[model samples]
Target: MDWDKLRIFHAVADAGSLTHAGDTLNLSQSAVSRQIRGLEESLNATLFHRHARGLILTEQGELLFDATRSMAQRLDAAEARIRDSKEEVFGELRVTTTTGFGSLWLAPRLNKLYEKFPDLRIDLMLEERVLDLPMREADVAIRLKEPSQADLIRKRLMGVNMRLYASKDYLDARGRPEKIEDLSHHRLICQNVNSTQVSAGSTYTQELLTYNIPSLLTVNNYFGVLQATLNGLGIGVLPDYILADFPDIERVLPPSESREIPVFLAYPEELRHSKRIAAFRDFVTEEIFEHRKNLHESGDT
Candidate 1:
């Protein structure tokens, strides 16, 4: 159980080549190979299968690699905690959220955050998958629902609903649907009913389909739906929050909308004291507050 040898083994397993691992670790190829050999000898395990193409991890190597990956994430978390300054917020903060909210909402407002903490480096991971925050897959998450994961500090950010919208041109050309039943004459753009999304959205889409809409465009994510709607393709089912930034898109069938989807901001309890987390949390909270204020002022709420 030599830490140095294990480190070298992890690198080699990761790169699948002695020379590549050596370049990364600043060791000669022979040195790297020697370390791997010694590690295998000490453990009495064949860690990798060597071939002309490259090295592939054996069963033992796969187990060790999984352990090392966890170790690396834990080490990264520790390093971030140690680097946090009392008064300064810098270094990397990894944030994960749904692609729609990240790209359509948070990403656009990040310039204000940079203006205040220019030294801060943010890695925005946008996808539908919920990353393991406690294991440091990401430092923070803004989820569409309250996170079911334990040992995390969660805050309800806001509530969102899937509502109908269309570009002004589309409405002017095709006309707006005054009632839900009138949707039968219009093209409906929305997230696919089978896509991985909040139940509320899929349910809303299902209800819309009951009207026997003749034309439909279904995307997996709201961004795609937003894009098609913006281009005047059809009336799109989208999150109401999008209205704060995309005010030009007119809301259609105002009485028809989805159930509330609660937005939550969550982080590991361990990160509760991290200054970077505090700064990011505050920035997002403030942004949402401002967004709500604007919506109310414009009577869109």
Candidate 2:
């Protein structure tokens, strides 16, 4: 099996169209098609079924896709490591982060880094879904939770405190809840479509029973919760940094029972010693640690 042909096949599978994949790789459509045909011939299996819409992967293709993706990622990482050894920070820094944090915090800070090192290209991937960093999907990942994988290095950058907050108008109309039991009477905004446990053997659904609040609005994204809270829809439990500038919003409950989401900087264990990765990791750690108190206080607004 030729690795180049496999790489082209993976690209086509990922892009879902020969034309799209060809554009991505700067190859002509004919060249990409030939490569895919070569790969299929080499493997003695039909990888994709052609359709007017796009190419659909066959059962054999699906299996090969999974294995080849991992292999391709490792190969790319190895090349990156080799290039880094030459003392040039000229490679791309593929970073994955949650939409909210990437937009509100990290994006702004990255400007200074870029200004300092113009050769260091940054591909900022903003998504709610966590990317598989071990497979080389990203060079660095800013995760809300600690990485449990044994081969990854996890650094706790800071703790994000979630507080219950509501607009002054909503509180004035509905009245403030004095105890956890009183929350049952008030309207609440619930985030997380499928509630997962933050810790081992723990379930968020089970934890929700403790609050026992009747949800007025359910949103999948944290930004949705913030918008709803701002509109005086209901009280929302959100990270403090998100609400820092909103003067109308007030923290309804003290820090009791507040969930602390630990922010972690995760990367492959092997890339820890790389100068570029080390520099970025240290810079982010120092900045966040210095502003930890401010991040907590910002939510009270």
lDDT of each: 0.93, 0.77
Native-vs-model 1 lDDT?
0.93
Q: Output the lDDT of residue 146, model 1.
A: 93
Assess every candidate by TM-score: 0.97, 0.76
- Backbone clashes under 3 angstroms, per model: 0, 0
Best by lDDT: 1
Report residue 142 deviation for candidate 1 (angstroms).
Answer: 0.3
Q: What C-alpha lDDT, on a 0 to 100 scale, does residue 257 get in candidate 1? A: 89
Deviation of model 2 at 140, angstroms: 1.6
Task: Give one digit per residue, the lDDT tens place, for model 2 in 167-270.
Answer: 99999999987776787887777565364323311233235446676666776656677789989997776666655446788887675334567889999988
